[model samples]
Target: MSAIIQIKNVTKEFKVLNRREGLKGSLKDLFSRDYKIVRAVDNISMDIEQGEIVGYLGPNGAGKSTTIKMMTGVLEPTSGEILVGGNIPYQNRAKNAQEIGVVFGQRSQLWWALPLIESFKLLKDIYQISDSDYKSMMHLYQSLVDIEPLLHKPVRQMSLGQRTLSDILAAFLHNPKIVFLDEPTIGLDVSMKSKIRILINALNKEKNTTVILTTHDMGDVDALCRRIVIIDKGKMLYNNDIEHLKGFFGSYRTLKIRMDGDLKQQAEVIQKELPDFSVSADEEWISVLVDEEKSKVMEVLNQLQKSHEIRDMQLEEISTEDVIKKIYEEGVE
Candidate 1:
């Protein structure tokens, strides 16, 4: 498949005012405001194919939002080029808007005092959707969200989850070829989040709509995205499939054992046997860290069972959260 979204060496910079400290210094600086250039996105480049769902993630001040804004044509890049569906988003915003949809978790595009159905009607008019297309789209969206009961309620009177669901429906009403979802499930309950995920997956599969999701919620990344792009300090850190990202840190595993006898004694014995590994124990449980390249978990367990009765054991792979956290702490290698 051809690349639907191409970002080439994109950089976005901002000139922020520098303020002086204390009353005397502040008074002197009021006449002349100094400024410094801060690059929120620096020399970043990637290509997203059509019909692909990608998770765009980063820590706060890591420029995730800045990148999205540039892609959506809300902000122009300081340098480099961004092409969505073969059009320059910042230059051909009106034409690009017809082919894309956007949803911001903290912002609403619906009328505040209007009924949900009325809001939908207004959007249909704004988009100039045909009667048959509007009805068909509503039918499909309602199947995912069950928006029947909430249609009569005013948007301002709905709950956070309800409002978000409504907003998502509104975004897709036009059936845009691409969509950008920014923290769509933020501040929602578990059930609401699940519903949102289901809706997103259904839309992607049914329409082949390309999606760019920006969120801190790992659950969203795990459920919907096979590929993820992470950035920090305005630089791209990692861009690959979820499994490949996990395999980057797959050399280590955690082994937890329940002992029939004294856990501390067993811990000491294991520690002696594997001097290079880190071993610790509590009342009834012992935990050991093993580097898979150097030692096998089964070998360690068999050696322990010879001296002490092993009640139970569990070997766990490191979680995606821990792996991403390590990247943030140590920077990408």
Candidate 2:
């Protein structure tokens, strides 16, 4: 399949004005202000194929929004090229807009006081959707989203789950070839999140719609995306299959030791026994991070047995959150 979206060496820079401290300083700067350039999207490039859901992930201030803005043609890149559906994104924005749909979690494209059905009607017109095609989509959405009950209620009267579901349906009403969803499941219950995921899967399967998802929730990436692109500080860190990311940071293990006696004594004994491992403490809990490939976890347990009585012991794999944190912390040094 041909790539639907192509970004090559894209970089977005912003000139921010410097603010002065004192009242006189602020007054003086009003006439002539100093500006500093900040690169938000730094020389990033990626190719997204048709009908693929790609997870664009990172920590806060990691340029997830800036990249998405450029992809959606909401902002222009300072340098590089982007082609969405064979058209330059910023240069041919109107044509690009007609080919893509976007939904940002914190912002609503729907009218606050209007009923959801009314909002859907307005979108149908805005997108110039044919009457027959609109009815067909509404039928599918009614079954897929279960929006029947809430369609008559005002958006303000709807629950967070209801609003989110409606917002997703609104984005898909036009049946665009591609969609960009930023934090689509934010602030929703588990069941609602599942529903949204199911709906997204259905859209992909039935219509072959390509989706670009930006989210903090690992579960969303795990459930929906086959490939993930991780970024940090406006740079691409990792871009490959989810399994590749897990395997790269999969060398570390989390060991939780439960003590029958005082926590202090147990921690001291473990530290003395395994000096190579990184150790930390909580009130009564003791956590040890050990390199699985280098250190033997069972050897540590055996040593702890001679010193302190063990009530319970558990070993867990480091989560995606921990993996990214470790990468960032190590990069700092």
Candidate 3:
């Protein structure tokens, strides 16, 4: 119920060699003392409360991974302080390991040759989980998903989705106070993604475990997180609830339409014509994010209908994904 993780003015810096352009420069670079300091996390601070699921979001090359590494005690911060459950992560890594579990996407903690249940049992032993606690976790997993089929299957034989699901379940098997999940639903289909999201939601509710999730998937953010922290270029941008973030772009509406023509070409044309609004297209829909104060939804639809044959059109409110994308492009004011 209190702040379980407190990060204060933490900074992580890396020293990179300044390599030269030419062959002679390359040879001289080995002996060269030139180096550049890159700050991956720049004086960012946040508090994660007990039993809260916080979405840690950023674009690629943003400081998400570096922050995670510091939290997990894989790397020590260059400056400032961090306390995970009142213990410094880097200083007390062994003790910290006992209290937190982590699952990195596509990187299985489960043994490849072992049956899924075998891997779970192995984790139980490693974490020293008791029989009663282990049974409770198993019961919880069964309630949300049918695990009987996947239990005996070797982890190597399971699909990407199945492996990811198994890895998440294993992470929670120890009943750790905190869990770090990095892109748990990556490379999964819609059905699998929905199932995993449901499982994560249920687990957090039932167990009251604090989760720090680093993901690019907006669906994950919408389904699992109430509070989100977004960062870019090693600097904190927004740390607030989803609604407050959306309120920044409150007047925007997503005009979704089904068209018969080339979606990519039509998207380019629409983007060129309406330089202010954002346009995106997929196989099924061309979603134009229109600022309602500047242009009406119907007006945008009418313009789209001019070149692209609109099979079906709907005016929907902007989604969390759209808002996040806008923030990524222009950043928060």
**Highest lDDT: which candidate?**
3
Worst 10 residues of 1 by lDDT: 245-254
Q: Who is ahead in lDDT, 2 or 3?
A: 3
After best superposition, candidate 3 residue 82: deviation in angstroms? Answer: 1.0
Give the least accurate 10-residue stretch of model 3, judged by summed lDDT: 300-309
Give per-residue CA lDDT, model 1, range 1-333, as digits (tens).
669999999999999877778998789778866888899999999999989999999999999999998988889999999999998999988888888889998788899999999998988888889999998998888677788888999999999998888888888888888899999999999999999999999999988999999998989999999999999999999999998988775577878999766778778888998897889998767988777888798887787788767788888887778678878888876
Error of 1 at 151 (Å): 1.2
- The TM-score that candidate 3 achieves is 0.86
- List per-candidate RMSD values in Å: 3.0, 2.2, 3.5
* Local distance difference test, each candidate: 0.89, 0.85, 0.90
Best by TM-score: 2
TM-score rank order: 2, 1, 3
lDDT of 3 by residue, 122-191 (tens): 8888888899989988998898899999999999999999999999998888888899999999999999
Query: Which regions of candidate 1 are displaced past 4 Å?
Result: 258-289, 302-312
List clashing residue pairs in candidate 1: none
lDDT of 2 by residue, 92-152 (tens): 8899999898988767778999999999888888889999999998888877766779889
